[model samples]
Target chain A: MSHVTDEVKGYIGVETDVGRCWDVVERGAVRRFAQAIMDLDPAFMSEEYAAQTPYGKPVAPPLFPLMQNRLPYDGTDVISERADDPDYDGTGGAGPSSNLPPLPLGNLALLNGGSEVELFRYLHHGEGLSFRHRYADIYERETSKGLMVFVITETDYLDDDGGLVARVKRTTIRR
Target chain B: MRDNDAARADAPADPRHFEDVSLGERLGDLQKGPFTTPHLMRWSAAIENWHKIHYDRDFTQQHDKLPDLLVNGSLKQNFLLQIVKDWATPHGWPWKVSFQFRAMDVVGSTLFVWGAVKRKIPLRDFGLVELELGIRNQEDRQSTPGKATVALPYREGGPVPYPFVPPSADELAAGEARAEGA
Candidate 1:
């Protein structure tokens, strides 16, 4: 018997803006990210060093663009909003941050299941990237924790020239 | 993965050759953290997700059933990429990677990201190196388990193709057939 409803299954091909960052890959931003991750690879950080590499200029770490998203609000709005529910996860609590469609399964806990990624090229400084997302599938299974839903989404990060940057298949587990 | 610190220090300064790699060869360990609140905070700020599960111990423990502030999966993936990317750079391309978030690593623990060459296949232009990799906490508990395929240049070549294109469908089918035959 299926625990997932027909309506939920209908989302199999639904689209979401999981993220879309078209801004130029900034060097400062790349440095901050690499520093935070503690990856001091010159390919990602130093333009002088990267200039000597095959890429000719500093490139964002392969996965750096995935984290580069701009929220639609200013900082004050968020601070004021977070003043109440001290328990708030800083997720703005206003919406599912990824722009994922509201799940019919209310209040269900969402967990990161895993991901499959294909990288075609390095995203470099001065390059702009765009994202396209779709609900690839939704299914349910009986786990030791009881019934859980697995939602898979496919996102493509494309360069301005329509070149492939990275293609990701992300899975979210709902319990 | 083999951790030959002596061998790593003696690694060639030039691009690596696919012919040099062997199955079961261990990659240099890429370590990150003893991550603290500031580390988590920086990552959250960079990614723009203030999910308190990573910073708020009270909410994470009381509201959610977690022991402490959790390291962000987003952060983990980036570290995974860095491990493969730095290892592949100057020669190889970290072409395709897949990893699962099997377990959670709470903040305040160092992570040893390790990789080992699992297999290699000869291709028309270059060779494909498959690797098994993961993140291990201070206690040696694995968290993110992954597999990656890297394309390496032949020693005679100048460099792997820039903006490396994905193999076409025909190429993939042929590769599959070859694998089955082998």
Candidate 2:
């Protein structure tokens, strides 16, 4: 059974307007992120050291953009809405591409197939951010397990001035 | 917070110059895990990713039909980036990276992130080093296979330009010719 129907393919080229992140880069968040990744770079914490670096301020790690989006205080609560559903995967609400309409595939298992990222600069603390997501492509492949649909989404992470910080292409697999 | 001094000591102290790199040089490995549930939970919370496959064992096995709580491919990417960034930073920049999650490493797996220089292209101001990188379990099962491009300054030159500027078409054509000849 092919999962990539015409409706799914229609999403290609679809894009969302540039959306603001829920919060600006915060020191405590960056610190927790660094600790979770076990990367203790002083650049993420020490203003004294970071001031001498090219960025001229404490900067988050290179991939910190992945965690910038969060559920807004006034947004719908995905957790509370699905509290009674045993199958809730805890994956919805807000994310890099959450603004895009969900794929038509219903109840199919989803996987994070892979990703490609081009980083131009590290995000400095206190900087507000924005992102825009587009569905670049959609196709189906017959895998050993069965037929699977691949959804390719591209997200551009931008600083407040609209300068690009990173471009990420991610693949989502649904079977 | 962990010891920043120790982490700094472990990271490359000086800038890694393009002139100093050899084609086949191997980067020191960065190891993490026997990843526990707390590790997975901490990562999910840090990123606000509530993917149940990473934390709910019953749902993962019964519904997702997996062996155990799987390690986050998202989390593993950080390890790959860390090893590359640690080896190339302070003077260089990790310009681009791509990786595929070919296999699932369940919870309790110890992962070793590794990379090696595979190709080098010299530009007018700096150099680009291409690397083959991946993550391997303790049993040597390769899960994430990828490539990266890192920009490094010349031994006597200034640091690689920040917010890195890609080489121009003319510079790339010239670099390609030089790389082919070398």
Candidate 3:
């Protein structure tokens, strides 16, 4: 029961146009994110300290780019829309790498397999961010639990000038 | 404004130069938890990740057929980067990190993120330190296992260039050649 049908395999090399986030890096969002992770580094908040650092300004945490693809203000409410659906996993709407067409796996459970990230610089506050992602690879493996499909996606996070901020390769497992 | 004291405590007063680090040296563990649903919820909300398994215990147990409200691999990853970043920042830069979610850490688990210097490669300008890292629970069950590379300045040199310029292929080859010769 190979899930790697020709259609699924066709998604390999599928890439999205560079899309900008709805908002620039905001101080408040960075604060909440830093607090949530319990990483209270002053470089992420204290303007005074950041000025002395090499970055010269307060910056978001290294992995902040991954969360930059937020829903627009006028975006549809998938949570409300799927409130009545029992199987809705609460993950909906276009996200960082969701611009690609959905894989043909029907009713399979999704899990985050892991990721490899190469960080060039931190996202500075007030800086606009853009991303382009591609389906780098897709394959299946037989595990003790069952057969699972692994989807590898590579996303490049860039600053307003299109300078690279971080490059992330994420693996999503479908069972 | 948001507890600057903790931030200052995490910040290294002095720069960590390449010469300061030794192979096989261990970094101080970064601990978080006994993580509860609130922790997972905050992380999910912060990132706007609506994965039900992180918050909806009923769905996680009944539908997903999991043991408990599983912690977000996303959140755990921050812990991984934090340990490396906190260790390398102020003077050095965390260049690359890779990890696999080999196991799961459910709610109520306390996670300790740990890292150790595995190898050090010295280029012409700066050096790269390779580290083996992971997260383990109170029960000593390892969940996330990964490796990282951090760029550090030599003690006699300036800071590791910001917007880190990775060593060119030639520089890497020359550094490896030097290491092999030594």
Per-residue lDDT tens digits of candidate 2, residues A79-168?
Answer: 899989887888789877789999888888888898999988998888999999999999999889888888999999999889889999
The weakest ten consecutive residues by lDDT in model 1 chain A span: A88-97
lDDT of 2 by residue, B1-182 (tens): 12122546422377788989998899987788888999999989998988889999989999889899989888888888888887888678888999999899999998888899998999989999999999999999999999999999998877898988878889988987898999
What DockQ class does candidate 3 belong to? medium
Off by over 4 Å in 3: B1-12
Q: Which ranges of candidate 1 are over 4 A from the true structure?
A: A1-3, A16-22, A73-88, A92-97, B1-12, B173-182
* lDDT values, one for every candidate: 0.76, 0.87, 0.88
Q: Per-residue lDDT for B125-177 in model 3, tens only?
A: 89888999999999999999999999988988877888988889899888877
Candidate 3 lDDT over residue span A53-147, tens digit each: 89988999999998889888998899999999888888868566767678888878888899999999998889999999999999999999889
The superposed Cα distance between candidate 3 and the true structure at residue A41, in angstroms, equals: 0.7
- Give a tens-digit lDDT track for model 1, residues A88-118: 4455433222555756876565677888899
User: Model 3 — TM-score against the truth?
Assistant: 0.96
Q: Which residues of candidate 2, in runs, are more than 4 Å off? A: B1-5, B10-12
Top candidate on lDDT is: 3
The TM-score values for the models, in the order shown, are: 0.88, 0.96, 0.96
Best-to-worst ranking by DockQ = 3, 2, 1
Per candidate, native contacts kept equal 0.66, 0.70, 0.74
* Location of the lowest summed lDDT over 10 successive residues in candidate 3 chain A: A92-101
Top model by DockQ, which number?
3
